[model samples]
Every structure is written in C-alpha cells, then in structure tokens.
Target: MARSARLAAQGLAIGLVVGLLTLLVWRVANGNGKGVAQALADGEHPTAPAFDLSRLDGRGRFDLASLRGKKPIVLDFWASWCVPCIHESRRLEAARKEYGNRVAFIGVDTKDFSGDAREWQKKHGITYPSVHDGSGSVLTKWGGLPIPRIFFVARSGKVVGELIVEEDLPRYLREIAAS
Candidate 1:
C-alpha cells in the first residue's frame, strides 16, 4: 500500500510539472517577439494554406484560389488594434499606390470586431478590400500565429514571399516583382 501511494505521488508531481511547462512554452511561443513568422520567413517556403473568408466590402466571399489569375496579391494578417499592423497598413497602401494594377492587396483582420476593422479602414484611407477572420479559423489555416504577418502570393498562384518586419516588406515586394 505504501508503494502504491508513492507511485501515485510521483504521477501527480509529473503531471503538475508537465502542466507548468506547457504554460511556459505557450507564453514564449505566442509572445510579441515575433516567433513563427520570423522563423518561417528565414527558414523555408511554407505551404500556402487555403483561406476563405467574407470580404468586409460585402463583395461576396474572398477565396484564395479565385485570386490566382490576377496580379500578385499580398494577403496581410492584422488587427485594427495592433500598432504594428497600423504601420504595415500604411506600407501596404504605399505599395498599392506604386503597383496599382500590377499587384493586389488584401487585409485579413484576425480576431477583430467588424466595426473596428471598418473604422480602421476609413481612418487609414485604405482603398483596398479587407476581410475579417474573427473566428481565427482561416488564420490557423494560413499559419498566421501572430498579428502583422504578410504573405505575398505570386500571380501564378504561389506564395513566394513572406515578411515579418516593416523594414523587410518593400524588399520582399521587390523580390516578388523581380521573380
């Protein structure tokens, strides 16, 4: 009986340690230090995940496949409340001005309210269309673990570039254009 009690105590201790470790890992992985996005941009060409969501412009649904034949599209995952996203939005608007018909810009507001996203668009003078992924379902598929992520999908229907920093954004766009 004493041996059984010792085993039970050991099992409980192990479970508590595991639970604490998991919480620590979660905090580190999803913290504001730019985790998965940076690793992905530096590592490899992640498989383009299917993203289907409703456009904020009420122009029906926006499916990733449907934007294939058009110009290269940049799908930016952001939220209205994120400061970095605000900066990224300005850069995206500049890109739109520069490329015009040569490129398409789409913003996905993850886990955000529709009113806030719409207000942000108006405040920022964003001419491009945006969609809300409030449920984070599409975000998970796109592998967007954090806010302020950018995916540059080439005209040939391939995600050739991604950027995590505002400084690297234009460079990525230039690379996409050259490619």
Candidate 2:
C-alpha cells in the first residue's frame, strides 16, 4: 500500500511540473498583441529587435545602427499581398510626408516579391525606403511574427514601442513623438 501511494505521489508531482511548463510556453508564445495604445494604457513598454536589411532600391543596405545618429526610425514590416498592409502603407506615407526630417520611416517587405512591393509603393506614393525580407532573416531577428507590425526606435537605437494595428497608428505615432 505504501509503495502504491508513493507512485501516485510521484505521478502527481510530474503532472504538476508538466502543467507549469506548458503554461510558461503558452504565455511566451502568445505574446500580448494588445496594440501599442492598449499596452501603454496598461503601462507596458514593447521593444523592437535590431534590424539590418537590404534596400529594395539596390542602392545600399540599411542597418538600424546606421540610423542611430539621425532621428528616431520607424520600421513597418509588411507585404503587398496583406490587405491591412495596404492601409498601413497609406498611413505611413502620410507620416513620412508630414514628419520627413523629424523621423526616418522604413518598410520591410516580408515574403513578397520586389516588383510587387515597388508597385504598391508607387501606387500609394510611399516616399520612404523599403527593404526586402524575402528570406525572413530580418523577420526572425525581429521576433518572427505576422506582417503589418510596426517598430519604433529611439534616436539612440533602442526600440521604444511596437504596435500591431493600423487603427492605433495615429495614436502610436503621437506617443512615439511624445516619448
């Protein structure tokens, strides 16, 4: 009877350990996608990863570190095929037009053809430069997630904010400017 009880206790302990591990993995994988405004409202600061990608123009490569000396950089990871990305392109073009020198805006086209990205930019009048992430190398470094993601980096090269929605963009940009 004692041996059976000991086995049962061991099983319970193992089950509890497995449950805890599963919970931890779930939390890590299911990150708080609660757009930037909501995260800020709850007092959270989202960070962006270091970025270095080749330019679509083929003129030169762009490294996040290179922009450190200049104004804050805003990066949008998107694709022409993404419906929401289409809307985001329009919004970013406006921001680029209004705050041209105040900030450096860039777009990273993920898993998309260069021609498609170029066409999308031309159609929307996007003045900012866009880099290609066809191999998803930059995306993996930037926390491999879905498209239409925005990362706001400070002038010092540190990421200060991350937003996942086009609707929350205006407020997110305002907050970034304030910060």
Candidate 3:
C-alpha cells in the first residue's frame, strides 16, 4: 500500500509539471511570450504592440495602431483600485497640457471596470483619453502587473522606454515628443 501511494504521488507531481509546461508553451505560441519590459531590459526597443479597445468614455473604440506612425505616444497602464496610479496619472494629465498637441497621452485601464475607471478619471481630473483593458491581454504585451507601468513610444512606433523613476516621466516624454 505504501509503495502504491508513493507511485501515485509521483504521478501527480509529474502531471502538474507537465501541465505547467504546456501552459508556458501555449502562452509563447499565442504572442504572450517575453514582454516589452524584458525586451527593453535586453537593450531592445520593440514596436509597440497594437490594440483596439473601447474607450472608458462613451466614445467609440481607440486603436493604438491609428496613431502609430503619425504621433509619439505616452502609454499609461493603470487601474482604479491602484492608489499609486492616481498620482502617476495626474502627473501625466499635467504633462498633457504642455505636450498634448505634439504627443498623444493614452491610458490603458487594465483589469478594471469601465464605469469605475471613468469615475476615477473624473475624480482625479485626468483629461486625456483612456481605453478599457478589462482582460489585461493588452497589458500583458506592454509588461503585465504592478499597475502604473508607463511606456513611451516614438513617432516611428518603436517603444522607447518605460518609466522606472519619477524623473523618467519627463525625460521619456521629451524624448518621444522629439521623435
């Protein structure tokens, strides 16, 4: 009985390992492989992954590809529940006032409800446009999780950099604006 139980346990462990491996392979096959953050860390400036999602406002959908070559973009990923996102987004709003004409400030409301995101935007006084990323699939491409991941894409559509520090915000904004 003891020997049989040990064999069963081993089989279950092997099954779990195989399951995890299959999931990893599936994600890689579906374009959910290495993220933009990893590519940046490896000294690569990849093209910003495109997404078309519904606007938090009642307006029509927003397509990232639409502005790809035409304008430099500041992509801000945030959720209503994230406290830190409030501050970061507010700062972006202030920056937008100065750079709005030259640069596009787009927000991706990741893994959050549309109504709440809209409310949050209003409450925080964030005037720039935002699209809902309820499933977080778009967020996965730009580097998933930890909320408030802001990236700058040049006019050429190449992702320039992500905001790593408070100082990075203005620096990236300037770089992308000039691109």
Candidate 4:
C-alpha cells in the first residue's frame, strides 16, 4: 500500500511539472512572456524614448522627434553579428517597400562596429537609414539588450507595440498599418 502511495505521489509531481512547462511554452509562443501584448491590451501606450544618432554610412543624423506627426515609424534594434537580425532586416526592407511612403523605417545598430554594420547593410542591399549605437546608450534608454527588438510608433509619437521575435513582425506591422 505504501509503494502504491509513493508511485501516485511521483506521478502527481510529474504531472505538475509538465503542466508548468506547457504553460510557459504557450505564453512564449503567444507573445505574453514579454509583457508587450499585455501592456498594449491594458492601454499603456508610452511615448517612444527620444534619441539622436548618426547614420551608419556617414550620412546625417536621425532625430526621433523629427519623425513625429509625419508618418508611422518603425524602429528596429539590431546588430551586425546577430543572425536573426539578418533575416529580420530582409523582412523590414520588404515591409518598407510594401508600405512605401506610408511608414518610416529606421534601423538602430547597437553594440556593433560601424564598419561591420555598414558592410552588412551594403551586402543586404538595405536602403533604409540606420543609426549607429556603438556605445549602446540608446539601446539602454529604450530597453536592455536583445538584438532585433522592434518598436512600432504611431503617427502621434506613441509606441503601440513591441516585438522580439522576427516571425511575428509582419503581423505586427500589418496591425500598425491598419491602425
């Protein structure tokens, strides 16, 4: 009888562990783990932090405040060495082309060498302007590390959504466009 009781207890513990793991996986897959979706759902639209950074290709600077009221802005934080950034860069370029003048796309190259960032952009044939955040101060101001983080700011200068995964980016962009 004691042996049967012990086996039942072990099975219950295993079931609880499995349930917790499943919940975590579901939360991550549905974008709840990052709290981004929850924040948006709670009507917590915050103004995107302002920053002025030089362009990667020796071009002029990009001022966040300058983009306000002009068009919807898409800010993508990336690094040249991050593999996922490469894939997301292509998707962003395609989205930029599709959206045309309706939206403004800006890439923030954080924690990467200027030469490497410029080379990556050139190799990828990226035409959008990219800001250099070598010191990562801008990244810190916006949020912490995580290469390939994206923020969608509406025309009014309010950040509507944030995304970490590249796969969910297009859907988020579409939702922004629709808004």
Candidate 5:
C-alpha cells in the first residue's frame, strides 16, 4: 500500500507538470505566437492588431482599424485594480494637453469590470476615451498581464514602440506624432 501511494503521488506530480507545460505551449502557439511587445523588441515594426470593442463611456463600439492612416495613436493598456495604472494614466492625461490635436490617446481597460474602470477614470481625471477589454483578448495581442503597457502607433498603423521608461512616453509620442 505504501509503495502504491508513492507511485500515485509521483504520477500526479508528473501529470501536473505536463498539464502546465501543455498550457504554456498552447498559449505560445495560439494567436499570440509573437506578441506586439516581442516583435517590437526584435526591431520589427508590426502593424497594429485590430480590435473593435465597446467604449467604456457608452459612446458605442470603437474599431481600431477606423483610425488607420488618418491619425497616430497612443495606446494605453490599463486596469482599474492596478495601482500603477493610476500614475501612468494620469501622466497620459497630462501629456494629452500638448498632443491632443496631433495624436489619439486611447485606453484599453483590460481584465477589469467596466463599472469599476469607468469610476477609476472619473476619479483619476482621465478624460481620454477608453474601450473595455474584459476578456483581455486585445491585451493578449499587444502584451498580456502587468497592466499599463503603453504602445505608440504611427499614422500608417505600424506599432513604433512600447513604454519601458518614463522618458519613452514623450519620445515615442514625438516620433509617432510626426508619422
């Protein structure tokens, strides 16, 4: 009986490990094979993945493709529960003052309740329009998890870069704004 129990424990452990590995493989093999962040890191200027989602402000659905070639975009990925998002989002709000006419500042509220997200926007004084990404599917295409992943897209719909430092916000904004 003791030997049988040991064998069963080992089997279960192996099964768990296999399951986790399979999950990781599936995630990497799926539509997120090379996420925007990875592509940017590889020095590839990939076209922005399109997504149409309902705006949190009840302004109806916003199709990202609609803005292609017409304007540059500052895409901010955030969540209501993420504390750091507050600071980053507020910084964006401040930046909007100077670039509001030249660039579109859009937010993706990922993996959070729309109601809470709306309240967060109002509380934080974030006036930029945002879309609800409750399923995080759009976030996955860009970069998953670790909220506040900001990306800059040129007027041609090509992703320029992702924010890695505070200075990057202004630098990418200038680059994309000129595109």
Candidate 6:
C-alpha cells in the first residue's frame, strides 16, 4: 500500500509539471500572453502605425497616413474566421452610424483570405472601409494579436486606448469624438 501511494503521488507531480509547461509554451507562442489589455495597462499610448493596403473590396488602396489630423480613428483588427468578430461587426456598424462622420472607422482584416473577408463584411453590412492585411504586417506593427482587437486613436494620431470587448467601444468612441 505504501509503494502504491508513493507511485500515485509521483504520477500526480509529473502531470502537474507537464501541465504547467504546456501552459507556458502556449502563452509564449501567443503574443507573449500580453494581449490588448496588457498593452493598455502599460500606459504607453504609442502613435498609431501607418500602413497602406489594398481595400478588401478591391476598390482602391487604403492609406493610414491620410487619416492623420482628420479625425478620431478606430482601427479594428479582425478576421472572418474569428467568431468574436462576427458579433463585434454589428457593434462597429452601430457605432459608426451613431458617430456619423465625427470619426473614421477602419477595419484591418488580418491573416484572412480577401474573398472571405469581403464576404464577411458584406454579410455584416459593414459600410466602413476595410483593408486586407494578408501578410499580417499591420497586425505586427500595431502589436495586436487575437481577433477583434480595437485601437482608438485621437486626432493627433496617438493611440488612446486598446479594447477587446465590444461593449466598451461605444463609450470610448463617444468620448473620443467629443474630445
């Protein structure tokens, strides 16, 4: 009985160690586990990175540099395969309508097929322009991971906030517009 109990304890200990190691590996692989929340918490509101990409609809090119000093800009990083983005899409369209010309809403469709992204936007009735980030260069530039990451930028081109939850976006948009 004593030997059996010792063996059981050893097995448990090994399992625990393996579990911890797996978690650590997963976290490190996924943006170092410092997502949008951590970026905001760091209190370093960096300048919004400038990018130029083809429009998702293939209409024309979308340039971030042109938006500087124009108005508050909301950059939403999303992918069609991402479930959360489907829900967030509705909120974004609503916010865009609510704000109505006071802010510029841009969607960055990252790591997704252009046709799929375009279809997704069409299904969601997204009127705001979206750019295809097929290479994920824009995502890396903004240090964003995980779909549905929203970055709020002031008129001065400085990032004001980073949000993952959709509910908080409207309030942030209202405040940014008012300011």
Instruction: Output the number of the lDDT-best candidate.
Output: 5
Candidate 3 lands at a TM-score of 0.84
Question: What is the Cα-based lDDT of residue 171 in candidate 5?
Answer: 97
What is the per-residue lDDT of model 1 for residues 1-179, given as tens digits with 9 covering 90 to 100? 99999999999999999999999999889754443345465765544566778998788988877767656778888888888788778888988888757777888889999888898889988778888899877776666567787888777766776775566678767766654
TM per model? 0.71, 0.68, 0.84, 0.72, 0.84, 0.75
Off by over 4 Å in 6: 1-39
Which ten contiguous residues of candidate 6 have the minimum total lDDT? 31-40
Candidate 2 structure quality by residue, lDDT tens digits, 57-96: 8878887677765677788888888888877777888887
Which candidate do you rate higher for lDDT, 1 or 5? 5
The segments of candidate 3 whose C-alpha lies over 4 angstroms from its true place after superposition are 1-31
User: For each candidate, what is the lDDT?
Assistant: 0.77, 0.74, 0.93, 0.81, 0.95, 0.82
Candidate 1 matches the true fold with a TM-score of 0.71
| Backbone clashes in model 5 | 0
Look at candidate 1 and tell me the lDDT of residue 83: 82
Give residue 117's lDDT in candidate 3 (0 to 100): 92
Question: How would the candidate models be sorted by lDDT, starting from the highest?
Answer: 5, 3, 6, 4, 1, 2
* Model 2 clashing residue pairs (backbone): none
Count of backbone clashes, every candidate in sequence: 0, 0, 0, 0, 0, 0
TM-score of 6: 0.75
Tens-digit lDDT string for candidate 4 (86-109): 877788898898885788899999
Candidate 4 whole-model C-alpha lDDT, 0 to 1: 0.81
